[model samples]
Each structure stands twice: as structure tokens, then as C-alpha cells.
Target: MLRYVTVSKNSLHDITLVALIHDIKFNLIKLLQ
Candidate 1:
């Protein structure tokens, strides 16, 4: 159970990071336009 929780937490962290990167990319594109 502990391992499962840890894995889920890691996945959530990765998702958040991806989301942040995506947002940054989107803003950069907007600025370029």
C-alpha cells in the first residue's frame, strides 16, 4: 500500500511538471505571435 501511494504521488508530480512546461510553451508561442 505504501509503495502504491508513493508511485501515485510521483505520477502526480510528473503530471504537474508537464502541465507547467506546456503552459510555458503556450505563453511563449503567444508572445512570439
Candidate 2:
């Protein structure tokens, strides 16, 4: 059960990181345009 909790946490962190990177890229593209 504890392992499952940690795995979920890691996945959540990865999702957030990807989302942040995506947002940054989008903002940069808008700025360039």
C-alpha cells in the first residue's frame, strides 16, 4: 500500500512537470509570434 502511494506521487510529479514545460513552451511561442 505504501509503495502504491509513492508511485502515485511520482506520477503526479511527472505530470505536473510536463504541464509546466508545456505551458512554458506555449508562452514562448506566443511571445515569438
Candidate 3:
């Protein structure tokens, strides 16, 4: 699909990726507590 290709083109932007990873890490830490 075009959307898939487009996202691949930009890799969802560095800022978006950072935020996503950060959110995941936060959730994981929260779970540990």
C-alpha cells in the first residue's frame, strides 16, 4: 500500500520514533513497579 511505502520513506520521522520508543519504555517501567 502507498501508506506503507510512505512511512518507510521517512521511517516515521526520528521524533515520532523516539516518542514511540519512549512511551514503550515508560509503560515497561510502570509495569515493573
Candidate 4:
């Protein structure tokens, strides 16, 4: 049960990191344009 909780937390963190990177890339593209 504890292990499952940890795995979920890790996945959530990864999702947020991916979202942040995506936002940064979007902003960079807009700036370039």
C-alpha cells in the first residue's frame, strides 16, 4: 500500500515537470515569433 502511494506521487511529480517544460517551450516559441 505504501509502495503504491509512492509510485503515484512520483508519477504526479513527473507530470508536473513535463507540464512545466512544455509551458517553457511554448513561451520560448512565442518569444521567437
Candidate 5:
């Protein structure tokens, strides 16, 4: 149960990081345009 919780937390962190990176990329593209 602890392991599962850790894995879920890691997955959530990765997803948040990906979302942040995507947002930065989108903003950069908008700025370029």
C-alpha cells in the first residue's frame, strides 16, 4: 500500500511537471508570433 501511494505521487509529480513545461512552450510560441 505504501509503495502504491509512492508510485501515484510520483506519477502526479511527473504529470504536473509536464504540464508546466507545456505551458512554458506555449507561452514561448505565442511570444514569438
Candidate 6:
């Protein structure tokens, strides 16, 4: 159970990081245009 919780938390963190990166890239592209 503890391992599962830890894995889920890690996955959430990674997802959030990816989302943030994607948002930044999108904003940059818009600025360039």
C-alpha cells in the first residue's frame, strides 16, 4: 500500500512538471508569432 501511494505521488509530480513545460512552450510559441 505504501509503495502504491509513493508511485502515485511520483507520477503526479511528473505529470505536473510536464504540464508546466508544455504551457511554457505554448506561451513561447505564441510570443514568437
Off by over 4 Å in 6: none
As for candidate 2, its clashing pairs are none
Cα lDDT tens digits for candidate 3, 1-33: 999998776876866989999999999999999
Q: Candidate 1's residue-wise lDDT over 1-33, tens digit each?
A: 999999999999999999999999999999999
Worst 10 residues of 2 by lDDT: 1-10
Residue lDDT tens for model 4, 1-33: 999999999999999999999999999999999
Candidate 1, superposed: residue stretches over 4 Å from native: none
In terms of lDDT, the poorest run of 10 residues in model 5 is 1-10
For each candidate, the alpha-carbon lDDT, in order, equals 1.00, 1.00, 0.89, 1.00, 1.00, 1.00
For model 6, how does the per-residue alpha-carbon lDDT over 1-33 read when each residue is reduced to its tens digit? 999999999999999999999999999999999
Q: How are the candidates ranked when ordered by TM-score, highest leading? A: 2, 5, 1, 4, 6, 3
Candidate 1, clashing residue pairs?
Answer: none
Residue-by-residue lDDT tens digits, candidate 5, 1-33? 999999999999999999999999999999999
Going through the candidates in the order shown, the clash numbers are 0, 0, 0, 0, 0, 0
Worst 10 residues of 4 by lDDT: 1-10
Please estimate how well model 6 matches the true structure, expressed as its whole-model Cα lDDT: 1.00
Model 1, global lDDT = 1.00
Q: Higher-lDDT candidate among 3 and 5?
A: 5
Q: What is the TM-score (0 to 1) of candidate 2?
A: 0.99
